[model samples]
Target: MAAGTATTAPTPEPAGRRLLRGKSWLATVPLLLFFLIGFGLPAVAIVTGAFTVSSDAETGAGSFTTANVTDSVQGAYWTALLSSIKLSALTALIGTAVGVPIAQAVLTSRFRMLREAVLTASGVLANFGGLPLAFAFVATLGNAGELTKLFHLTDHGWSLYSFTGLTVAYLYFLVPLMVLTITPALEGLRVQWREAAQNNRATGLQYWRHVALPILFPSLLGGFVLLFGSAFAAYATAAAMVGATVPLISRQIADALSGNVLVGQGNLALALSLDMIIVAVLVMAVYLPLQRRSARWLS
Candidate 1:
């Protein structure tokens, strides 16, 4: 059409490059299979079972029903779920408050040994929970525990099996978890930002309030979401420590599965599990967006 006009043609991809790209997907085959077998199948089963009821108890034949889900949200089950949410929220908040300062301290420390030591301890402790953690607290704070007897804490109406005590137990690991989570975000803060604030006649508190906190807010909230999920799903520690005394969703699920309180309530267990899955999905929905924002700033 035009004598002087130059048109660019797209380069064709080589056959070998196309073949290599096809082969690259093969590497993910194992992981895909593992996920399907491990998570996907179980998730499908839970959802399906939550909506089914037995047509014949002996033969285990089932029919679709919404009764399981409806039952899961009433009476004791509802109370247990609320208790779990409250406990998780409380521990997550306290853990975040405690952890941020400790993380900042570890990040600002001049001594490498101290930093390494704290980090190593945090790594170990954050992964420490369940029966052993329960026993540890019971031994240290129970009615007849050493410190309890020594300080006569029981006389002051302190009980290790109560909500307050469970909170203390949760904070043990949750705080360390927060420290591990928020440390990298703390490290992402540049010295230049602090210097700029100083050059502007900003005090340390002013710098943190305006510059650092704004930047770290996403990470902090993400860390809170993590702690909330951890505490929410925790079963073993609460089961071992408080038993039926403190009604928890996890405990209720366990009881439903084991038929401890009723016979043939397996579908109810699945329903409870579905509730947990919904909560976890909501938590991820919040966490993922915050993580993306934090990565943009920190990375």
Candidate 2:
């Protein structure tokens, strides 16, 4: 060997990398097309509709205007916005409270059979949504439901059509999502920290407060944002449970499009535009904090 340059043969591309690069374009083509068709075109149309209204007799041609937003902001739009925020906040808090404990149990338990059962049950529960899930709960918990009729619980006059019932349905979805998001973080926690704390005679609560909480705060908060987003966007569960009794923002928006809640095409478009704006703002607010926290973790 003449020098360091001559000491070894040059490295070659790994089989995995070569195969991936060679076939990646094939996979990307379908995905790119899907994104363009499914997301890009609809988004452009919504933006256009949000800015304009149909022309009246005074106007010769269809016109563009900003009044769609201004008009909505002045009307029931504000009420819907406030209601959505309140519901999302409540759902996020309740979901996080229930989910954190379930996630902790799932991640920390050394029982393999129990862990597998939890994973399987969670997977099934995660997909339980829409009207069917609502009716399932209704049939079991409602006044006419089996549980009610079988035990004469109907005398108690329980109903799954109240705001409280809607909250329960929302939690049914929210808790699973939180568990899914937090479990990975829980598992990723290094065992040594807990062991060290235990060796030092730290109580369970102290270990959680002083050792685990700081490490998991970012993930927990991110999971909270996810739960809030789910609750905010959900329509089916709310509609099935509350009907027209509770005027949730989503149900209202759906009614607008079908001319059942608010009248006029312009109003429907305006409501949808308002909803889009609210979602955009909420997503930005949640994601920015989450990103900053993640950056701090990396640092």
Query: Which candidate ranks first by lDDT, i.e. highest?
Result: 1
Put down candidate 1 lDDT per residue, 1-299, tens digits, no spaces.
78999999999999999999989989999999999999999999999999999999689899999999999999999999999999999999999999999999988899999999999999999999999999999999998899999999999999999999999999999999999999999999989999999999999999999999988988999999999999999999999999989889999999999999998899999999999999889877887887788788788
Instruction: Look at candidate 1 and tell me the lDDT of residue 113.
Output: 96
**Whole-model lDDT, model 1:** 0.94
Q: How many Å off is the CA of 47 in candidate 1?
A: 0.6
- Let me know the TM-score candidate 1 reaches against the reference structure: 0.92
The local distance difference test score of each candidate is 0.94, 0.75
| Model 2 RMSD, rounded to 1 decimal | 4.2
- Would you list the clashing residue pairs of candidate 2? none
TM-score of each: 0.92, 0.80
Residue ranges of candidate 2 with Cα displaced over 4 Å = 1-29, 56-61, 146-159, 199-201, 261-263, 270-274, 288-299
